[model samples]
Target: MRALPLSSGSVLIDLHTSWNSANEIPISTTLAYFSSSFRQTRRGRKGIASSSTPLSSSSSFHSNSSSIRKPSDRFSNGSLVSSSTPLLSLSTSRELELFLELVPLRMRNELLKHDELRTLIEVVIDLGRKPIARFPTGDWVISDETVKLEDLHHAISKVGEFSDDNRSGIDHSLHRISAIRNRKMQIIGLTCRFGRAISGNAEMIRDLVEGGGSILVIGRPGVGKTTLIREMARMLADDHLRRVVIVDTSNEIGGDGDIPHSGIGRARRMQVPNVNLQHNVMIEAVENHMPETIIIDEIGTELEALAASTIAQRGVQLVGTAHGMTIDNIIKNPSLQILVGGIESVTLGDEEARKRKVQKTILERKGPPAFTCAIEMISKTEYRVHHRLDATVDAILAGKLPRFEVRRVEEKANDSVTTIVEPEKHSLHESEVTEKEYNTTQIEPTEDFIEYPVRRMIKRSNTKPSSTRTLPVCVYTYKILEADLLQVAEVMGLENDLNVTDDIGTADVILASSSELKQNRWIRSVAKFHKLSIFVIKVI
Candidate 1:
């Protein structure tokens, strides 16, 4: 096969004469065919070639009349190829050619010639069964030939060995080939999935990515979470010049090789040796690499979530994707809940309950979220952004639907357009508790809600009114020795006034040992919401 560049920035791929005739094809053509197919396929699309001309003879190679247009640009105006078939102009089929190379030669040519290769999602090959091609539009085409053990072995030999996850990927390519093994661990089936590195996929959330806050992207499988993350890593490293590191667990983000793919730009990648040890690698990236930002994909474990929080607390920005459709889903998952500040049951005082008009025992955020912002990928082109993670979670816990901004990317006049639909302010009702709840209770004659007590505490003592004197400060100590705390309080002549308590709700201050505070995030968050004074005690 030979590739020739055209004036229109496209390339023309001329398949070898042997490929034209099944009888003349050689077994050695398998590997070369896979390599050349992807190289030419990417060039055809990225170069924007209007046509791909198959050259049979030397004379016909130079003949313009023999060229066939790619047919993709012609369908750019949203015209259907047939009444039932819609054109997939936005889809990339470079990986499809690589997948096609793995099937038997006779069946491969037939499947390749299909008009809907661009929309092909996966190819299923099983022993004694006909090879099946699947498309995103729910279309399936079965091959005439049955898949044999030899065909499966030939395909496996071309790719890297399958990992413990039963997944293998093409080197320097996004295509993934997963194995289905029998009871004896013999490969019985293969699922060839096409993975595309889509550029500009992160444009919908570009602003949030560039804002420098930790962002957690949530979506169902195959919704382009990894694709968007690849783009974000590239944009941040190349455009913004940030020191970005990707914790590539399965080589999915950076492709399947020791050398990272160019799709990630200048971003550094740390490959995890095992899927189970992904959390350790995440922490390693922070301590050893000193990256300004860390990008992790599919944070599904409790340890990984805790590691993510640890990285965020150290002031390194985190860009991660998780297995969930929305923020609420992650909150409900015990193992992954730490990513969004694990949920906890807070027992509100009778006064606090009556004021908010909720039950005494209510679900509350455990701590400040590891991620400051969350994005729900509704579809490949649509996203629901919870710009403020804390407020959104709080609202959800209060039995109120949190308002989210909708961002959509649409193709208009051949240009990608991003439209942000903000929720109408008027549409948001007052949170379940209203001013009427507070009004119903009679206020004590001498007591008043002194808002901004912290600010008042900073003022000169003489400027404060005698009647509004500060009360004894109750303290909750975590990991700090209670005896040491009392000794210090006594030395400062405030032991009677600074009493330590076990109840978080009754405490006026929380004196947490820094080491213990890192593990118990819920305690820190409860103190924050209660507006209690927090003092971190570091022990040598």
Candidate 2:
């Protein structure tokens, strides 16, 4: 491509050549003459073009130029301001190509230094009115060669100048912004070896998409979890047109300030400015925006898990990452457990015997056999099979699988249930009980087990409430009725130093008093949050 300045005036004409060859040299000389005639008829600061030939011919190279209208001229119409955008037009793709080269490298670095590069980039991309192209590695690629600087400047101006009331403009730009390199063919032509993405404790990207599996990816640092997630989003969104909305917490997926420097397909995304409101943004997207799927980076808190569950409840699929090396580590976490379904113990069997037995057992059970495929972790590059036997044993012990299978896997069933039992209690000293509370000792033996109700009182104080500190004694009074709450006391066993209550606001896990127990929603909310160990006393 070459730009020719007309001799008679300031008019410039751009010529584009699809093929690069020596024969195109004559066309460049011919383009210079065309530029002169285009400039001769114009007067004052305005410039016009008179084409010797229209652009509809099958010439070796085609020439096109707009009437050279100055920025002030375009902006000066009868209304005091003109509607013509002074920014570079998308009339020719090559103008975008030249404008990107004008961006100073130093300005780009200054942008990268912002504390919230991700959110800034989201804003920039939202303002960029061009479609993006997807590469196989899952990062978005912009040729910079194909984008005009004027268009980019307008987008950057929009992002940097936004105010609270103009947030609607931001939203509008974000929905239209894309994060992929737009092309008719793959930018990189190498075949993707996909079996390895599981090393970081993730299933294959293809499996998650095809099976509609909502994945919770976990990995130790430096394990390529982010890389996998980027590629996964791009493939699913560009290839399948799955409506994937990502909450890029750190901008690692797309990079700094508006145009996605990384490829993530054509998916639309929201970048949370600070990490504080991530859990909240995800919930809002699911509730208000009709997203088919939601993706978040590094789930960090209990509140996030609660929000993810709410989205899943609405049937919107979720994909997120966390820090861990194994499935067991995730399951053991109170916050992580909410988003993740448990992985049954996996024991790989030899193909010949295992396949035969699996086929026979699946036929006999008469229900769809549980997933028994081998699961591989991407970080360690190791493999293990999720077997029918292990799943059956897990289900049977949990009252999900039937009794007939329980008998077949006696040892396995016993081992699995051992992981679920409540811990044993140590003896409490009698001196711990105060003189005024010594008479309140109650014990009962039901057919299945024993229950204990004991009371202790030692001190009185006025202190600010703490969620981390479990209360030793609780009493409920409502509608002038009193109920003993020894079970709540045992569950919130501050004496044992375990984090028992789920509330982040209060130390005491008190149920509603008789006056409030009639409010069924209030009662259930308390019980669910506290997870008390035994029966809740009822008083009238």
Candidate 3:
């Protein structure tokens, strides 16, 4: 690199490439090439742009430098301030000052709704005795002019008095302000446990932040989905350093007075109260605000989703919360389906579709058109992500929705480990039996009648004499069904009752355990038709 001086514009080249005959290239081309190359490099290396220009193999070293300077440029050092570390050594108070300065004027009244001056101090304050926090070279300081505390309080008081009319709106603005403060201070990231942040929809957030995809959290009212979204926002802002902004429609993200109640480690955050300008905001954030990520809470209306989709098309990262549980719930919402493009209906073959069933009662009762997506859940803590797994709706109709589980292991003493089981089962339809197959008869048992009868012979004297008829004594055993096994097992405790076969219409007694009962499904049918009483034991 070499230096040059020109009045209007100037170009300089590095002659170290060993070729002196090369014509000078336009500075704009060099800058454009640098920008384009930097982007490619940044993408390849996790967004860290580095110049990979090859050095010339020549021996001669010649460089050129240029500067188009004005007379006042005598003091200019041409140093560029790097934004790589925005919060480095930045004090809390300093951040607060910069925030106050950057906020749009129209919303300032709402953001500063709390502090007010007392009546006693208004008389002594001069016109210039006002407090303002300023930042020069990104370092914050209060103005040098001496001012009474009452003067500053008066300004705060004015905003507070004006905000009482729209207390709710003002409060929301304050929360938005607070959120920005914490992001600047890096507070929320300084707190919280890993894997303990979300419930019922944790995977959705994880996928959005880590899966290189976008996400929307939707559920019925009181499911606390938005709260989960806020925690995610905090996680991203505090931990990821990914620029996040909340287009808070209901003032939920930003708490009272432009302050976010929960800190999301966002470098920049803006709140628009009762905003009808969502598309404008999204465009502004990307075009002017330079946000890498954006978050909006409760995208309830059709217009909001439309604007959100537009924002998505611009290649900015988005995370949002909506209301609904199933994809049908989402489509029925009208606004959401239109915004994200409604979930596609699945088609299936007759043999494959026969096994499918609706899992939710709400969806079953008032089902909407089908949508293409997957559903997963490992624990109550989170639900799994759903997406189009196959090419056609028929695949989904075939009950081919992808299911996944997260395994957790617990360790005991001596490093003994036990795995917690998370079973993922497919949604299936149950076959119904007809009424003609049901048995309506119930035979009453006589008093003292035993379910299993066995006669124990007690011999008075060990005599084997007297008209003893020699006959073959045959022993028979029958297996019982699961239902009958449990019923008979409840009557016998700590032992299998094999001695009660006399009245059972059998010479031998046999009691079956649950395991045996399952293997013998014909026991109930056999017992019912043959009028035989069987006692079955249950195995644990």
Candidate 4:
């Protein structure tokens, strides 16, 4: 098999020849070209492609003298900005061919020839099951042939040695191959993940990087966290001229081999010989190299979190990622909570507790967090930014939700990227709070006559708010029947948390009709004085 690059801006892949043991390929071996579905964005950009008959996977790669890596462009901070983003550091899937080259020729030519796989994410192969291909849209059964020992051997031979973590990769490419072992400790499966370096992806948070404060990014796995930090390292090293060092574990961030990939630009990389020694290497990066910025891919350990705090104390900007959908995840995680400020239950004095309008004991920040700012990645195009970690943590402890600032990004087919910074909102809607708060499985049905209250501090319960258990809330209902609301709470399994209180002084929240609330000026004044949340209900 040979790749023929034609002058008409298309490459013809010659699959007619035998790729396995010199045997003539079957009649299905036909020439493949870039399909119309294959979108070619710009001269330097990479585009996803598919064929009528799958040649495993195909991509559109175009390059020219103008398509060189340039400094990433950032949109000016605003409510909305449609500024056309310039061609950032050029990216291409030219190296993707290396991943394709690893497939056992027999499997590639015969097995994956008919299925259409686009926007490829990963490929899974198990010993007894048929090989499966996964992409962003969905998954597909790429081959009828069950993975055999010979096929696994073909892959293991082509890649780097699998580490203690059961992960290996191509020396220069971003493709990672991870192994699965049975109870006997024998390899039985392999998951191959394709990695790409996206330029200008971090441009949305340019101001955060320039602030010179430690920033911790929290998100679910495979949300492009590694790719984001790779660009950040490059921007800090090549664009801003800051000394940046990356603690690349498993070669996911910097690729494999002694030499790091160009994706990180001039930033120096310290490869961890072993995953367990990552924390030690993190400290070593600061004590020895004197880097201005240290980029860590995943801070999954308490020791690593401690190391991060130590790094922050030394005045080095720390940019790292941890596994979590929200900063609250980091706050609740015993090991990772230290990354944000550690939580402590403090018993307040009589006057202090009464003045705060709460029980004697409450959760408080132990100290300044390692990271000054935390970013919750909603998606590649959207992000929830928490500028002040200390303030955000304090608000959560006080049973008040912190304000949210969101950033939205949209890329045009014409190669221009647009970014919009939505206006910040301090209050969350009733439905938003119901779905998001406390991991409660049941939602109180919205009623026209009754307004559902958000999470409020219940004076009855002393236990801390947790995802597993609900925090009881004290509600002082004026004119609205307490029995009706109490019945609703019982059905939703919030009976223990929801209680009716006659004394307005002890209530965390007030529920009353709009007409009644107007008649009772004293109640309104007291609620304002206590800074309590008010829910308006209508007469049934």
Candidate scoring better on TM-score of 1 and 4 = 4
Worst 10 residues of 4 by lDDT: 73-82
| Whole-model alpha-carbon lDDT for candidate 4 | 0.68
lDDT of each structure?
0.68, 0.39, 0.38, 0.68
Q: Per-residue lDDT for 1-540 in model 3, tens only? A: 333434434333332221321222223444444343333323322211122312111112123324332321211111111112122211222223222322223223322332221100101122244233211222121334544444334333322221211222222122121111133532121000011122223333454465534556556553455556667677666766677777655454554454444334343566563356665665677777766667776677777777767766677767776666654455456566654354443444555334332111111111221222323223334454544312212222222222323333243567634433353433322212123222111112212212322211112112242364222222234553445433443454311332324233444323444455445434443344334444444332
Worst 10 residues of 2 by lDDT: 401-410
- How many angstroms is residue 154 displaced in model 1 relative to the true structure, after the best TM-score fit? 2.1
Residues 45-161, model 1: lDDT tens digits: 322222232212223322344454343432211211211121232123224434455555555555655667666777888988888887767646567668888988877876788
Candidate 3 runs further than 4 Å off: 1-208, 343-380, 387-540
Per model, how many backbone clashes are there?
Answer: 0, 25, 51, 1
lDDT of 3: 0.38
lDDT of 1 at 136: 65
Q: Model 2, 1-540: lDDT tens per residue?
A: 444455645444333332322122234455345544533433233221221212121121233334343433322221112222221221111211122222223323332233332222122232233323222333343333334445444343322332221221211111222122226521111111111111122233355455555655556754556666766677667777888888876555544346543256576678776567888888777766678878777777888777776776667767677777654465467666554432333333467325432211111122221122212244433222222323332332221211111001112454532121221222222112222222211111112211222221211212323676544334332232222233443444433332233332332433333324433323332333233222232342
- Give the CA lDDT, 0 to 100, for residue 427 in model 3: 31
Question: Can you write out model 4's per-residue Cα lDDT over 1-540, one digit (the tens) per residue?
Answer: 444454556544332122621222222323223432122312343222222222322121111112221111111111011122222311232344456545665555442343343256787878888887777767777778788888887777778898988999987667789999999988899998877777789899888888888888888988888888899889889988999999988898888878677788889999899989999999999999999999998899999999999999899999999999987788889998888778887887998656644546656778889998888888887888888777777656544456557877876678666665653554543312222432211112121232433333222233445574345668888888888777766665667877788866667778887787656534453455345667776444
| Candidate 4 or 2, higher TM-score | 4
Which residues of candidate 2, in runs, are more than 4 Å off?
Answer: 1-204, 341-376, 380-540
